[model samples]
Target: MTAALAVRNLGRDHGGGQAPALDGLNLDVPAGSCLALVGPSGSGKTTALRLVAGLEVPDRGDVLLDGRSVVALPPERRGVSMVFQRPLLFPHLDVLDNVAFSARVAGASRRAARAAAAPFLDLVQMGGYTTRRPGQLSGGQEQRVALARALAARPRVLLLDEAFTGLDVALREDMHELLHQLRAVLEPTVVLVTHDHAEAAALADSVAVLSGGRLLQHGDAGRIYTRPASVTVSRLLGGRNEVPGVVVGGEHRSALGRLRLPTDVAVPDGPAVLLVRQEAVVVTGPDAPGADAAGTVLAVRAAGARRALTVEVVSPGGAAVQVHAETSPGQVFTRGERVGLRLPSSAVSAVPPEDAGTEEPEIADRRTADAGRMPRTHRVASPAVPDAGVRPDAPGAPRRRNHHGDHGT
Candidate 1:
């Protein structure tokens, strides 16, 4: 079961703070699709989730499901359910009873609820564990049962608050697969709160970015990742290189050289910030064909199957820029080795230096697939998840005015 969700002017104040924990948040989740709320800690991702779940009251705003306001409804009557980070299963109850708890609350007999919950338990692959107590199940098993419990209730909208955060990498991947399966078959409307960019990219049809209790940007998952609305949003999505530049016509030029702006994006003439995703940059031997810049390796660190490097690039005019990049784990570069860089035009985005709050969130909601409109499942990819960095609030850094000798590496 699924229903569209609308959040209008949602505001919550924890008090004693400079800003409300959640302020004027607006989002729309298409029936049977998923939206992810992403940001740093205290960005109101969880606060928004709680408000929508009716677990907490909003200081202002209205929550509408399928166009009907549910503000007066208690949590139990809201036709929604939440799955928390921890399984928090009842230690004494067996798996089957745990999943049937909601039905039991609704006045169903134990035998009737258990029988009704059998299929949901099977859906999560825990049917055989019905007699096992929560304490006897593994962490992953407990979560699976928890998910079953939430599903057995037939919620019109499901809220997941870091439900997979505590799981190990392998277990998280397993849960992601299960969720994909559930969405494909059940098509429940969902709002997920998580700090994990990769998780959001993998699961959400759309992404809503928030910071300082204000909505920063929201849009299609791909748009949010490839073309962030501001430098803050780009950094949140893990875009590393912020090349200060000027846009003349549609082209952007920085000290490093030129970056072809996306044709679909109309960048105003004058100062702009060219966003180069860290993964979009490919390092090669100095003087390699199509090399955009030359740089000398400053540092390198290998972690598991990925290698990270800090490189300092020098221009012909003696300007220097530090860039961060990643390469295959097996590829090795010495600290002093010189390298060439290639930044694909398609991977670059341009945003005005202003970096203000988001435009109407309708742009995000407008892109959502209409109710009963089946969307593709399991779509997931992004430019590398680079290290987070501070926002470059101001733009138009120094640039080279004149060219001299050969371009320096």
Candidate 2:
């Protein structure tokens, strides 16, 4: 299958004491499928969209639409339409006229443009508000109208840059449903840029994760979420319980105790990082049999349907590890109480350690360049594992025990 859109070796530089906005970024969007560009602020999500839209020229590489290069083509010439974070509607035009404007620009008569835009307005569920002006409509309603307008151009590719960022949770969900329904009917290739993982998971068939203008990983959303290519990608996708450990033989040894490696995961025998999902760590009574390790509860916070606990576990060598776990609402545990924790081998995977010498400096440079462009609050911070102080093994310290009975040599 040929790609509907292709970005090959894309590079962009802002210059003037700033690092490149995008460097060596590449991605592909299959025809009639949705691909989401997700990452922290200043990760070049918007820059990638703009390069494909012809709003900005790339310093290197090319943007291709259906195997044809469009890097030098103007935005109007490319068969692409972009929706920004805010609705860029014409103030003087009513919702109907705004939706019809694109058709009219393409030389359709006023009557013909309105006729062409009517079905799209209905597609977005904005048919009833056709006579309202942009100022009179709510944010969600305006966005709906903006979407209808974009469709009026009959674009082969639709680009959305944080298009739903301003709406409330309920409205954002409604828009997601609308987009899904519209995609079923129109089947246009879509590229969405968002910081919300839920939005990406809900709308995208595939996700491309970026960090510091570089593509970290790109694959099916389910695979990316469950088996991220690196610790950085795992963190971006909300894999929170990262433990520093080492791989010996075919098992992993960490503060949580030794765990057997699954056959599918292949990692070199050396220093590694174990990525564990919060739901995978089972917390039980301290005396529970078959427990992997024992830890003291440091904090418990109520999440929506479950509660999150911060547990501090100690290794035999006195190294301290802090991990997060989630439990049901019915289960209650207090701080300072001892609890038994189990790290299931099935839910754990190992990846090579992050090479700080190369990636960190580029990330810092991108952050500096994006300081003024994006609000500080909008930037997604790199995930950090809370550290528990390392101390000498006290008298009667808990002995190392492998509940799985798979201790590594």
Candidate 3:
């Protein structure tokens, strides 16, 4: 049966540095639900998964399944199964034997084990290839076999560590659909570790964003994307349009201009950031329907259905800033073209920069020439974000439609 999984105060250190692989990670995955632990490299995503799978021991905290601690249990005894990035199928064994390995270990007869494996193989669409070895299978086919084998064990909790990363986009989409099928029929609690926010959003019921080995934000995909706790979480979720500003008198005054705070967002008068998705930033002709912030188009790149444009704007309080906007591909916007940008109050989020010092937080760059690189990693995990600055449940800001498909969260 599916079971609730709770990770309480989980901590881990691999030595050689102050930054632990995972630090004080607290998470809960309801029965038959999925939670994606999304983060950049070295952000403790896999380490947390290992700790949960009994492959690695935690330095502190407890792992509870259905309100019972299983710290002392072995991996085989924990009633958990993990699928790694690679299939890791036994090279010598045929698909049938590979899937029946778990049942064989349980002292079942070969026929009984194969009988138990057939349904899972059919579940992952590998039933026809029962006699084929791992070497004969394609990357996607091997992953299907691996998944079937994992399911053959009938674990209560399933952990996937970037299992679909190696597949092409189309194959990944196929695997995603297969996972949905598996979850619906098997009903196992799932924890997915991924670096792609879009993957997390598409698969998981909830997302727990991690950075520097710390829990930055955790909630439904829409809420986490729209209302990130800090600049760090925003960057992780591909929030490129960040305006440095301060909130005083219930309004955010920044280079983008003054914006009245949404009712769901409550922060004291202090340094803050105005985060508007590129899709939310409406771009119009310079003179038509003037907006709060006006800018000149610095560059434009056509990306099929949508065009990504970088606009340069300057205000008295701030230096020239590049605001990225996504527009229809059919619209022709050239460099040096004057444009007006309207950041709808209902579509923007006001969050703390969390930078008390002069140095601005390293924002993730997803636009312009030097775009798509991950931010620099911290030597140690960042401290937990304070509750006062976090407004996780902000229903006031309407969820913006994502035009980027799998490219966005």
Candidate 4:
């Protein structure tokens, strides 16, 4: 299958003695599929999208669209449409006209443009708002119309730059589902740039993690989330357990405990870090002992549908390794209380020390020293476990909802 969009060894420099915003980054978006680009601010994610859209040319390498090198093409000729964080609509144009602007600009008659834009508006369920002007429409409505506008352009690839950032949770989720459905029916290759992992995990066919102007990792969302390539990728996905340790005497001595590495790295015996996901840390007690367990609960907070319990586990050297566990309704613990925590064989991952920054240990990691030795092992409650980050504190959690209507991710 031909790639709908491709970037190879792409780099760009802004020319003021700063590093290139985009360093030798490469990625391919299969036709009729969606890839989510996620990273911290200033990670060059938007720059990459602009490069693919032909809004900006790379300083090196190339961008190919539909198997053709379109680096020299203008934005209009690149066969792509971008929906930015804020919907850019013509103030004087009504919804129908805004949605039809692309076609109109391409020499289609006003009547023809409206006719062409109708079905696209209907796709986003904004058909009835066609008569309203941009200023008269709500933020979500304006975005829906923007989607229609982008679709009417008949682009082979669609770029969304945090398009739903200003909407409420319910509206944002609705847009996410709408985008997926549109992709399935329209069959356009879509690339969504977002900082929210939950959004990426929910909407993307594949996710690319970008940092420091480089593509850190790209793969199926589930696999990437479960097994991130490095500590950065793990943390970017909202992982709470990043324990830096060293491989000594064939054992990985982490604050949690000294355990043999499940796999070997090319790096010979030295300091390393373990990237563990909070979901992988199972909370246990005397009644429910766990493997390589050692920790005392530091704090626990009810997080919407699940509870977050922070624990500090001790390493062999008495250093602290803080880890968080998502507990279910029946499972609960309190601060300063000893609890068994389990790191399933599949949960622990070891990466080089450089990727794991030496920041102040989280509250849970500090309590690991007070934790006891003599680890306990617990049996799996359900051999077959079927289950289910961010975005506001939700209704139950303490959070401040801003007037701009943006929620935490």
Q: Number of the top candidate by lDDT?
A: 2
Tens-digit per-residue lDDT, 192-244, candidate 4: 88866788988888999877688889998777876777766776666767677
Clashes per candidate (backbone, < 3 Å): 0, 0, 0, 3
lDDT of 2 by residue, 188-249 (tens): 99999888887998999999998778899999976677678888788666667778889999
Q: Stretches of candidate 3 above 4 Å error? A: 287-292, 302-304, 316-319, 356-409
Question: Residue 21 of candidate 3: its Cα lDDT?
Answer: 77
> How much does each candidate deviate from the true structure in C-alpha RMSD?
15.4, 15.8, 10.8, 11.2
> Cα lDDT for residue 87, model 1?
66
User: What TM-score, over all chains together, does every model reach?
Assistant: 0.84, 0.83, 0.84, 0.81
Worst 10 residues of 3 by lDDT: 383-392
lDDT of 1 by residue, 281-380 (tens): 7889899999888899987776458667778987688777777778765778889999988877777788888534552332223224211222212111
Top-down lDDT ranking: 2, 3, 1, 4
Candidate-wise lDDT, in order: 0.76, 0.78, 0.76, 0.72
**Candidate 3 per-residue C-alpha lDDT over 1-409 given as tens digits, one digit per residue, 9 for 90 to 100:** 8889999999998688777878899998999999998866667887787788777789999999999998777677788888866676767789998888777777788899999999999999888999998899999999998888777878889988778887888999999999998888888999987766678888999999887778888998767777777767777777777888899978998767778888888778998888887777888888767487788898787755888888998888667778999886577788899998887766688877765462223333232324632233222221111011111122221122222211101
Superior candidate under TM-score, 2 versus 3: 3
Off by over 4 Å in 1: 16-18, 354-409
**Location of the lowest summed lDDT over 10 successive residues in candidate 1:** 383-392
Candidate 1 clashing pairs?
none
